[model samples]
Target: MMMEIYKRTVVGEDGPTVVTESVPGLRSVSLGLWVRVGARDEVSEQQGISHFVEHAVFKGTTSRDAFDIANSLESLGGNLDAFTSRDVTCYHGRCLAEHLDIALAVLADLLQNPMFDPAELTKERRVILEEIQSVEDTPEDLIHDLFAQSVWGRDPVGAPILGTPDTVNAFTQDDLFEFTGRHYRPSNMIISAAGHLDHASVVEQVEKLFGSVPASPPARRAPSSAPRSYQHYYRDIGQTHLCLGTTSWSYIHPRQYDLLVANTVLGGGMTSRLFQEIREKRGLAYSVYSYVETLEDTGLFSTYMACDRCRLKDAVEVMWTQLLVLKECGITEVELASAKAQLKGELILGAESMSNRMSNLAYDEMYLQRYLSMDDTLKEIESVTLEGVYDACQTLHDEQGMHQVTVGP
Candidate 1:
């Protein structure tokens, strides 16, 4: 099948930004307004406001009451949702192509004009506080948070995107308003749409709605620092939850493809070394895998496992031994081929929907500043070799790279 992608730039009195493609096929379109600011952009005092502001945007807008917003989307059989991550916040929806205009209108209203109602703010604070508490209650979730804190230290990336109870409770409407005013600008945002839409018409609608908003000065850049080294945490839980990680590379790094294959062989799939060795052969844990999280400037390769408390130390040692094996002996041709096949299959399956495509487009534009066709991405993954995988693993296994966090009984 031939995949056609359109690219254009919408420039107005407000600001200029790129919109890559609006795919046309399904009855529903996935649309999103992505902003560069997220948890990492905030200072300690402002840590959770990025996420808080995301929630507040749906409370009400100048043109649409919260009820009206909900009713309008439901009337059209659409779903409206939003998420805040370490690096970005997205307000997105999946709606019938016929409701594209309505969806865009509501989205623009929320992005540009949330009222930040005082009572609503108070209620949401309670909700978010409960969310923080819930995370602490779930060992699986809390252990990762502890792991992140151990890995990234106290930096914004290490900090939970959802602020702590103390911070979440302390947040006021003023804080949300201040954060929104600073980060919610046309230049800082990208409006991406996919499935059954004319790219030009969507661009025109976006320009009309967002045209008058002024661009703010660029966001302050985050500082660069050396990779963090090994640190471990001990906690009491029935099963030992562990996150072992090391600094890898950014999304744009040259060795990214190699790292991708290495991760797959180590932990990406059911047949991966960690899964086969730790789970299948030894029956040490029900869950064991490795993966990579790549950001704009840096990345991490992480292996997560949950095993009986008695087997925790052995699990960690076995995981590390596999890493060392990959670095020293590398992978076999058969293993390399299997990893490549699995990675290709996953990519093909993941892009089969408009929502997935919309998210891919938004992330590519935000992080890589360009869109890569599916064929290009697949070709890169397919071309990875055993030597390349070994080199990437070696880089990740540097002494200054590893970090660990464990929670157990």
Candidate 2:
């Protein structure tokens, strides 16, 4: 099906940005109110305020109680949800085309009228404390956070999204309001929607709901540089969790697609070299894969594996062999073609979801400040040469730049 994407600024340079993707035959629409403030924007003391605000907003808005907020969209066979990431927070919902106005209204109300009641704040504190404990109890999940911290030290990029227990416990109603007031300005927001929707109506409703919000200049905090390091934690778990990672380029780096191609060849799928070498060929691990994560300004390229403690050494050696081979010899034309096909296929398949499309619009705007159509992305993937992939591999495995984090007894 053909789709149309429209981009607009609600007022001017300091106003909220809006992008809508109109799909011809979809019955539902997905909408997101994206604030460019996230865990990465916090200082040492305010570590988890961004995530705290995300949860507190649902406790009660000025017009809707928690129960009412919960049912606002579910009553119409739709759903509302929100998430906090390192770089952004999004409150989003999906509803039938006929209920677009209601969805937008509920989102705007949550942002505009959150009460941040002291009582609700107290209840949420306990929930989030328990949530932090849950992560501590899960070794596989905790290792990534540890790895990130090891890589970036105390920088906001490496800090846990859920924040530490001490930090979360100290968050008061005032803290949420303070952070929200500073970062939730219209200029730092993006409204993106996909599926059956009209650009004009969405823009008009958004302007009425948000146009009056005062603008604030974006606050930029330069990231502190940190060196690579190794860490190991002893746990009573049966299997060892290993994460070997190195730094990479930012989201908008010219060689971003090359990195993607190299990452795919490393651990992207069942056909990927790491999966095949570590799991299928040697039975060293049951779960082995590589991933490329690019934030707004920096990125990480990591390969993760969970295996029997006894097999951890073998798995690490084999993973290293794969990396060295990729760096030294690069990928064959056949492997390159297969990786490109895999990426293009996934990109196309992902576009089948309206939520993905909605997110793509926001992400592209956030990172590139422009829309990158699927065709453009496919062409970029197609343009990655074997030499480019080699350079990407070499960049990722820089000597003295690699870091390792392991968790297991």
Candidate 3:
């Protein structure tokens, strides 16, 4: 049976925007409390405060200890987690539809009243420092951070989310309280939920929990400058990890789908040209893929591959060759049709998850300022013609603006 999905939005005059999608016949609900501040909004001294707060909140809250918070949802056979990104941070939970109250209560406590004990902060700082070391030891993961530094240069958007050891070590309990007090106000919050739920019920609970929290003005973000053309890091690793990319359109732009389709044809899946040529044919690398990330004001289109040091040149040559081919000569009608089908299938399947729907609600509210139904998104994908793909390829693969980062011996 086809489930009837209904979406609604409500904003207070002094706001923590609330949006909900009610999917009838579902047994569970996924909810998230989103904050607008992230790495991009931080100054150099507080590079990872946003992410630090994400971990710190889990340590304990005023009403609950760390163990209680950890077991809050799991005791009900559900899940709870959070993440900080370049633009926002989210603390979310999922549980049976009837237990929605528990999920909401636990998340609200974490958001409104993290204890951030000095002893806890000290322990978390060491844990985060260990995390930094973990990333440094993994070349494949570390290279992406280096790649961002290479691409955005000094832009705050390019700063690592985990932060450097110095900045993280300097963070105190007061720093967290200050950062959260500034960014966790009503104006910076969005409460989103999906699956079996009632919009008014959720809103009423949210208002009761958060009504007294005062609003604040939004933060100003600096524009990103032009990306550098190339960068290389020499590591003693046995294989070369290469990430090559260029700027692309923002998520809100009408042309975003064009870049999506272009990416699918290049290295999105096993059938993609880079995967077929570089891995299947030449056996240069076991993993090679292309990805696109569209931010609020800008985006990134990048390809990554890991290969034997000696084969790095051949692998890069093939990667660029495929990119140029797609740019100079657009994909065939059959290719376009196949890519469209792939995208539609993934979209439809992903929408079935309450978590994905909950996330889509917040993302659209934050970035697009409007919601797009599944039909709307699918139509946009279908509308991408060969000419559109060609234009996307040409625009995204511009050699002058391209950035390259390779980490290997």
Candidate 4:
């Protein structure tokens, strides 16, 4: 059965707020405030400021202290959360449908009226420093950061999303305030809601809450990238973790869906070639997968695995061999059919959630500037062909375009 995904958008005086049509008799609603600014917007001097702002906003707002802010949501048996990434920072929550107005008001207040208390800033700075140290201690997670550094070099886009301890230590309240003023404008943000939402009611509430926020475009810059290279870091550890990667087109590219399917065939699922060949056949490693993350202007295609130090070389060899095989012989019809179906199934399953739907709305408004209907997305996934996926592999598998990062003793 083809399910219809109805979406409505209201361009209030503040900015655009989009609401996905509600599911009949759904239990919860997900509300999100998405700002199109993130770590990538920071310069070397301002690194980590965006992430700090993400944490700080939750600390308190003008009317609600951090405790009040938290209790307000929890009392309703709802959830509150926020995260900062390379390109965007989001504050999102889910609650009973009847409490949607309260959730919306709280999120709007946090965005427009954060207190940025000095004491809270100091506490968050210490917390972030500890976080940086924690990352240094976790090799499985650290390898991906190292891989990004290798691929992007010194570009801010390639820098760690959590920022360095030094950078975190250097940020000030003024810096955070300036960053917020610069990027947290109406024109640079989107409000998305899904699940059991009354579109007209939500729109009316959003206009009243946000109608006064000034709208302005953000200053933009491009990231600098270097050619792919091999980077090895020696650390005394029981297992070696590596991130093997290559460059690929950004989200707007025509071949993105093809790349998505190709990535799945390579190592995405437990039944994938990497999992089958590495674990089932050779018993090299317990964990292995390939993933593709496409941004507005760039993308990363990476395969990650962890294994005993003794098997590192063999594992790398096997992983590289899989890439080469896909480039030369391409995926078989069975693999092609399987990958497409898996991708489509996953897409459908995610549609069952209002949180995922709201997140999708934010992503579309921030990058694509046009809403992509779920039907369109499914069609695109189905439209991918074996030849298209093969060509995508051939284009991305170039030796000159591949980068490898290894961390272990």
Candidate 5:
């Protein structure tokens, strides 16, 4: 199966910007046309433009109207969707193996020939405005964005991937075209497909479809330089939303596997320390968990909980205590082994989904620039020693690295 995984970067004027991956044997296939631009790539005024473009691209393409675009794949028992993130935008979908070419053609058409109609842009602007308002109405979701803004400060990386109402309202049709032209280039794109598919044939299709779109070098934003810090916002809400986090390793960090174990032991699930201590033992909140976001150049370790305003102080104090305890004493041998096993099982289970495999393929090509066999990845996870977990815990929990954000009255 290891030898069955194939990845190669096509080279030429019409060559693919990055390599593609194919993992056979499944009855269906998943494909993603990844572009290297998102919220973080936009200037202050263009905050949500990347995400807007994601929606607009699907409104219609040269060959497919929005209705045809929506039904083209579904009529064949396939799916289609796209999303924008802080670092990248992905147009991805899944379908039965026999329907791979349909998925590929629709996706290629969307990326290469989006109509971006003025009427569609007008309708989407209102849709996005409602989306921004929905987030404002959901405290749990809004608080994380607030936490990010607080910690990352003025950096665009900290900005909400869904831009503010003002920015969303300001995007014009020309703005959409300008953004797409600047960033939607072969040089900044990675096309990945996984499951029952032919690698050479997929490559040929990509070259023929995308190669015609001339490549343009994007003027990307400079790397973020802001230091992590805290900001507390007062809102007259029933439950308080809070987060404590700090910077951690990037995607390529050597000790990230150890960090993964440390995070799991801390609060990766219901059985995690944060959940057990904060929710089960103390009854401080209905929801509590710790998570890490590992990006291309940076990462974040954050723990979030929503609890009664009265117990806010106590909840925060308990969280800090656990952090200090982990930093000082490290996780137990029992906990370390459990976390490792859980992580391994999750990786194996996740691989079963064609969508996940397709996503993994895009990420590896976009960030790692090489294909890593499933065995290779599992071995990396398996190699994290108990001592390594301790080191990771101590470093991420270093007192100076921590910060806090709380949102509620």
Candidate 6:
């Protein structure tokens, strides 16, 4: 069966450009506004502005106060949320299909008309600082930050999405305004909605509401050369959290599918080698896994583990043993088959919701520059062989691919 994807582009008078897609359904609808700017686009001084701006947008808008904004969404039984990553920041809402218009309007207001109230800015700064503190409290999370710093070194990809307290506190209203205006251009924005709705009518409403922003050229930067290896911090926690990884493929790389399958058999699932060997058999760690993260230009394959401080060396050895085994022996046909089945199941189950479909569509356009059919994606996963998985594993196990960071007692 062929999946239908509907798309429309809205050109405005003076504001940002909007691109949207519709996935027909009767249940929930998700409206997502994706902006092009993120941490990678910022200079050292401007580090956390993208994430800070994400928070400030909800403080208030020109026409609605923060409470009013929250109340409006609540009244429609919708949930509003936003996240900033190294490559993009997205503001999204999920609601009943009938409430799509209200959700879209709220998203538009938050993105374009934020008030940046001075008092609210102060309040949010404290809120964000507390968020930073909260993350520091989680050793598992904190170690990844340290590991990212180790792998990417001083590059933007290595930077935390949450700005440090110094940068977050130093941000002024002018900084928020300047960053928002420059990065939130029509051409750099994507508005995607999926659920029960008429495609043409949805396009019309979006055009009426957002058709006034002018597209501006976004700031661009050259890519960083891949790092050989780097390490920075060693913090004291009861259980040591360590991440060992190196840069891999990007979203567009042909090897990504093979890597995904390989990761599944290696650590992406509960039955993965890392879990079976480390947690089930050896009892070295309650939490240990390997996964891959692909960015616009580069990617990372990492193994994360947290265990008793005394067991740190053993845990590292166990993880390294598994890597060596994977590189030399690779996966069996049965394992490859199991991994493919699991991967296919996840893809189908994930697509049952409009929100997932909408986000998937937008992500395809933004990263891959084109959407692969569900069948095509599934076929790609199915095509991954034992040898392919082994080759991918070997590449990752090479000396140039290894980087590690540890935080513990």
Error of 2 at 131 (Å): 1.4
Candidate number of the best lDDT: 2
Worst 10 residues of 3 by lDDT: 1-10
Q: The CA-based lDDT of model 4 is what?
A: 0.84
TM-score of 1: 0.95
Candidate 1 deviant stretches above 4 angstroms:
13-20, 212-236
TM-score of each: 0.95, 0.97, 0.97, 0.96, 0.95, 0.94
lDDT of 4 by residue, 264-379 (tens): 98988889999999988999999999998788888888999999989988999999999899899888889888988998898889888888888887787777877788888989
lDDT of each: 0.80, 0.88, 0.87, 0.84, 0.83, 0.80
Q: For residues 119-232, write the lDDT of model 2, one tens digit per residue.
A: 999999899889899999998899988888877777888899999888998888877887888888877899999999888888888877875456564565646546767789
Worst 10 residues of 5 by lDDT: 217-226
**In candidate 5, how many Å is residue 196 off?**
0.8
lDDT of 3 by residue, 198-310 (tens): 99888888877875456564565645646556777888888989999877788888888988998998888999988999999999999999999878887888899999988
- True-vs-predicted CA distance for residue 59, candidate 4, Å: 1.2
Q: How high a TM-score does candidate 2 get?
A: 0.97
Q: Candidate 4 regions off by >4 Å? A: 1-5, 212-215, 221-224
Selected candidate, larger lDDT, 4 vs 6? 4
Alpha-carbon RMSD to native, per candidate? 1.9, 1.4, 1.4, 1.6, 2.0, 2.2
User: Candidates 4 and 5: which is better by lDDT?
Assistant: 4
Against the true structure, candidate 6 has what lDDT? 0.80
- For model 4, where is the 10-residue window of minimal lDDT? 1-10
